[model samples]
Target chain A: TQLLEQSPQFLSIQEGENLTVYCNSSSVFSSLQWYRQEPGEGPVLLVTVVTGGEVKKLKRLTFQFGDARKDSSLHITAAQPGDTGLYLCGGGGSNYKLTFGKGTLLTVNP
Target chain B: EPEVTQTPSHQVTQMGQEVILRCVPISNHLYFYWYRQILGQKVEFLVSFYNNEISEKSEIFDDQFSVERPDGSNFTLKIRSTKLEDSAMYFCASSPIPGYTFGSGTRLTVV
Candidate 1:
């Protein structure tokens, strides 16, 4: 089974602070996606990294895929209270299934 | 932006009863998926549907679970004889390829 392991299951930070969450797996994936979910809501896609060592940034958020496609990272710069939510990483393999990580609960206090 | 729509945001049903969750994927998307997340647990993939048939399913998707794209836009997931353990937030997703767009989800509470 391909499993994605996320680090720092829980995080608490003040507004304007910076934080980074990591996702790692022993198996390689064709693509990796990051999602942010609020309470009582489904996950919303943030970004998808398809190529190895690729980095994509969206405003204050930055996502990076490992050179081997076995790991990924999400970095938030100048975090805000609105950014507080559950961050998830999903790995898409050769098949149609997507294996999701346990997720990191982020709390950005204003 | 197009979105995947799921019906019945919340459902409470007795154990051993049958329940069907519905979804309307994006008009142009070809792939559909079902996933569930128990409280405080990770999101788990249940099944994937493509071309009016199931392409992949996880171990958690057993005989009790079935999926159908009966019409042009509607996708449904039927859970026959639901157990208390089946209670969770079920999310429906659609994608053109690997990247998915998920619905708001239906919170299924099997009592």
Candidate 2:
């Protein structure tokens, strides 16, 4: 089983639409990170949330860490075709490894 | 901006042959890692290295897998004997903290 669970395993939306993807875990973590990946490339770090109940915004992308540090959400405002990619959530797990989610495949139609 | 660099963006090898994947992490970073993603699967950790030694490894990192920081700036992962199932995209990463920078990845195809 995946330690981190992401919902809407696949999301397809039109341009100008908004969407929210979620990550949930039963275990707490010291930090949670979100990454966006395109085909044939490595994942690029989008944001990291260290403190509980903290909210961070990267332009149109908004990220939030739950008060317990066990969940996280990514909200995209006015999605664009460039926003299409794989969104993955990961937490600092044991052995210095990041426990990754199954990921949500988001495809924004232009 | 600094980035982790990986060579041979793609590799095709016969089963039972050995392959060594190379990486040059960002200068001044002390921690290094190897992660791989099988097609349609989430990225999985293979091993982490620090201070010239392995600090952690996953169950998937078995006898056939080994990691070494052969030089001050270069790190490598070797698969002793490749299997058909070993085909995947391997990524190299470096980190100063929880945040990490990853390489574009090397797609390994075992035939």
Candidate 3:
């Protein structure tokens, strides 16, 4: 089974602080997707990285895919209270299914 | 932007009862999927549908679970006999290829 392990399951920080969450897997995937979910809502897609060693930035959030396609990371700069949510990483393989990480619950205090 | 829409945001049912969750995917998208997230757990893929048939299903999707695209736009998941373990947030998603757009989700609580 393909498994994605996420580190630091929980994180709390003051507003404006920066934090990074990591996702690691032993299996290689065709693509890696990052999603953020709020309470009582489904996950909203944040970004998808397909190329090895590729990095994509969305305003304050940055996402990177490992060169081996076995790992990924999400970095948030100057986090705001509105940025607090559960972040999930999903690995897509040739089978067209996504294997997801347990997720990192981030809290940004105002 | 087009969005995936799901009906009955919250559903409560007794164990062993039947429940059908409904979704309307984007008009132009060809891929539809169902995923669930237990309380404080990771999102798990349940099934994928394409061309009016199931493309893939996880082990978690058993005989009691079935999916259908009754109409060109409506995709539905039916649980013939729900167990307490079935309680979770069920999300429906549609994709053109590269990315997926997910619905707000339906919270199913099997009591």
Best by DockQ: 1
Report lDDT per candidate.
0.95, 0.93, 0.93
- Residue A53's lDDT within candidate 2 is 100
Task: Indicate the docking level reached by candidate 2.
Answer: high
Best by TM-score: 1
Q: What is the interface RMSD of each candidate, in Å?
A: 0.9, 1.1, 1.2
**Order of models, best lDDT first:** 1, 2, 3
Residue-level lDDT tens digits of model 1 in A54-77? 999999999999999999999999
Segments in model 1 whose C-alpha atoms lie over 4 Å from true places: none
Model 2 chain A weakest 10-residue run by lDDT: A90-99
- Relative to the real complex, the DockQ score for model 3 comes to 0.73
Cα shift from native, residue B79, model 3 (Å): 0.3
Q: Model 3, B15-106: lDDT tens per residue?
A: 99999999999999988999999998899999998888999999999999999998688999999999999999999999877567899999
- DockQ for every model comes to 0.83, 0.81, 0.73
How well does candidate 2 match the true structure in TM-score terms? 0.97
